[model samples]
Target: MKTSSFYVAFDEAHKPRGKIAGNYSHLKEFLDSQGFICQPYMEFPITRQNLSPYDILVIPCPDFAKFSTNEIDAIAQWVKEDGGGLLALSHAGGDKGRRSNLSELVEKFGLSFENDQVLDYSKNFGLENLPEVVNFSPPHPITEGITSLCFRAGCSLSTVGLNVVPVAISNEESDPFSTPLIVTAEVQEGRVVAIGSYEMFRNEIPGGFEQPGHQEFCSNIFQWLKTEYREKVKTGEIKPKVTIQEPTQNYDANGITANVGSQPSFISAKLNLSSHIVISDKSDLANLFHGLLDEVTVLKDQIKTVIETIVSSEEQILETQKATESAEAATPLELPPNIEPLPVPEPERLTEMPEKPKSMKDTKKKTDTHLPKTKTHQPQPIPDPLPMTKEEIEVELETLKNKLNSIENLKDLVESKYKNKSYTKAQYEKQIERLSNDLNRSLNRIKELEMQYTKGKK
Candidate 1:
């Protein structure tokens, strides 16, 4: 059994829309399965003293409450000086719509949430708000193995140069082109990640935690966030304590129940933490049965809370409303189906289609000269009789090399799709065969050009 080493705290104060016991229960369960200690911090006015016990702090979109400047400064100090990981999530329309100030807290680390929702009408899961993102630029750790992600009713993020960077971005067809969907920064000794969409890892939906790349994305972000500072925290290298009192609650390893006027809770799926006891006789068996009955009672309450949160989930509808408004505002210029806008008119106008030659005898009387000559296309370029110059050889060689580069790039793209399981074995092998043939031909042509160019130079 993997012992819990890394401590993770979910900020439940300031009235966050999601919590461990409710909308985010699945996320809590997943982390618990990984053997991480998950808890909720319900303490008010988040201070450095209140944050000392944990290695990572996740603030999942405070609804309408704003964090005090002092609290923000303390959180920043903890991350920079003491080496703690910070993950902040926000919805669409950002601070203004949510009536919160998460941007101010994250701005200290060169990241901020934008007042916008990402939408792609051409590509999505039934609606424009759920934009499917395939573009991962510059290849950072958070997006390492992610091929695609659904940014469900989320906003976009902005980052400053160098210190902060975007790992994932929206598709080309999205409203905001190539804007950052996920941003990360490494400040001093700690790490910070800000995501526009919190629902990207929410319990269950089309573009929820079950999305193909999202689980891997969560793993990557957490692994990167667990810095050397966290390692030291585990080793007891530094003994920083939370001086402020934390709300106490029983840790239910199986049930993972957390509620208001309650501490945040997560179930231990991997770590079977229930106290071990030997059932030597009838008395021990009776005691175990009593405990199991008690567990069933707690689970019922947890289920009730989960249902309530789901119904109340996104009460403001800030992200969805904002996304809808954006969609309505930007109505695409779509032409009627099956007809494309033509820049130039066809060769012959509609009236000039040869008149159908009234009859065969009339067509025979009409000379072939009336018909337009169909020009024959030649695939190969006509050769010059004169000997070629070295400059011309150099130009041809460069062009052939460029063709070879294009072929190689296509090969890499196909291989990546196969590795990600996006392509079937048969499709992969067939494409590889065709691309390999093209690849060999390009290589041979380039080789011939190089030889000709060299001989010409000589």
Candidate 2:
């Protein structure tokens, strides 16, 4: 079980240089503790090749300069081809802080940032500017354990793509009835999360993550983004290079060279006239080449062995099939003979009955009394009627909702029973896994129905 670290790059070009703001030290510290290597993006004119090495690219409150057309194109292509993750953050009032244009980049993935800021006078933190968000969409991993979140001067966002989803939304009491502050979308093979307020991740900002559930939300975001890369690293899909500790010193060919000690100090040793053996040094070179050739020969032998093993396996498989066929042909199956109907026996005559004791006869007479027969009737079957389009959609939507509720209840029951010590750890885990799968299916069905309903309106 080997593990590897993922490289995370922050966009320094657009980072807020304000002494107090635009810094991601807190975010970096949290990610670092999770075994991620954080660094500033070095590519000036960002390209796909330059961004390939990093698993996630963080664009935090870009204020000074917006992503150029080329940079946007490269970033999109990089995410699509490299299967990387992206975290794009923007502040309140659209680009109020003179930030660079990010909509152009995110719009390519079907995400749009609203210009107006979302504020709730009643459900805010101290000041009306910082709105507390309590309304969250149903059971997403990102918002699984999260119940509430607070935003500072954050704008709203929306997406139209089927793969795009709103992670968190403002309550109906807010100015915008159902404003989505945070969103996530699947772009090709990559994942992108867009948060409206950069202040939420900042350290010293008022109404910052110090509020309840904010830190947990951030952790969820990190977990979702890095889950794939972490698995890849553990399975050795991505390898990190190992560096040597020896000092590397380069020497110049100044016509004169001196060895300070017996050990060679240069990363590569200089060839002095006295040390050089012109044509006679062929033996070492020949031996090195011969060793390489021997290695090649060994590889060829291994390949040949593998091919032979595969061929043998194929032959064995063919032989097994032939044997199975021969057995089936040799032992032909026969159908069972038809079963005969049993003969019905006739009843004995009453005149041949034997006499019984007075008490037994009296008891039998009392027990055997005559009864009247009743008639039987068959009911007609009812036919199913054709459902209206709207009625069908509603029925499906209700069914999905009911299934979702059932899953939730089952999940709660499992947790309660596990807590009560009714289930072992292994049993609890197995049940949880099955319930989670059911929950996911129910959510997907609900989303599909909602989409269909919206399209019907149009």
Q: Which candidate is the best by lDDT?
A: 1
- Consecutive 10-residue window with the lowest summed lDDT within model 1: 263-272
| Positional deviation of residue 355's Cα in model 2 after best superposition, in angstroms | 99
Please provide, for model 1 over 1-458, each residue's C-alpha lDDT reduced to its tens digit, 9 standing for 90 to 100.
11137778888666565566666778888888876767766667678876876778999887667899999999998898778899999987789767789999998896678787787888898888888988888888888878888998898876542367778877755755456888898887889999998878766667988888888888888888898865765565754433323334544543344443332333212222335444555733653464455445545766665665455555546678998899999968899999988899569745655646556546346467878998999799867545556776666566657656766786787788789996678767865775576567557756766787777777
lDDT of each: 0.73, 0.64
lDDT of 1 at 411: 75
- lDDT of candidate 1 vs native? 0.73
Query: What TM-score would each prediction reach against the true structure?
Result: 0.55, 0.50
Compute the lDDT of residue 164 as modeled in candidate 2. Answer: 75
Off by over 4 Å in 2: 1-3, 17-22, 96-99, 227-230, 233-458
Task: Show where candidate 1 strays beyond 4 Å.
Answer: 1-4, 236-249, 253-458
Over 154-216, each residue of candidate 2 has an lDDT whose tens digit, in order, gives 777755444678878887556543557899887656788898887786665566656677778
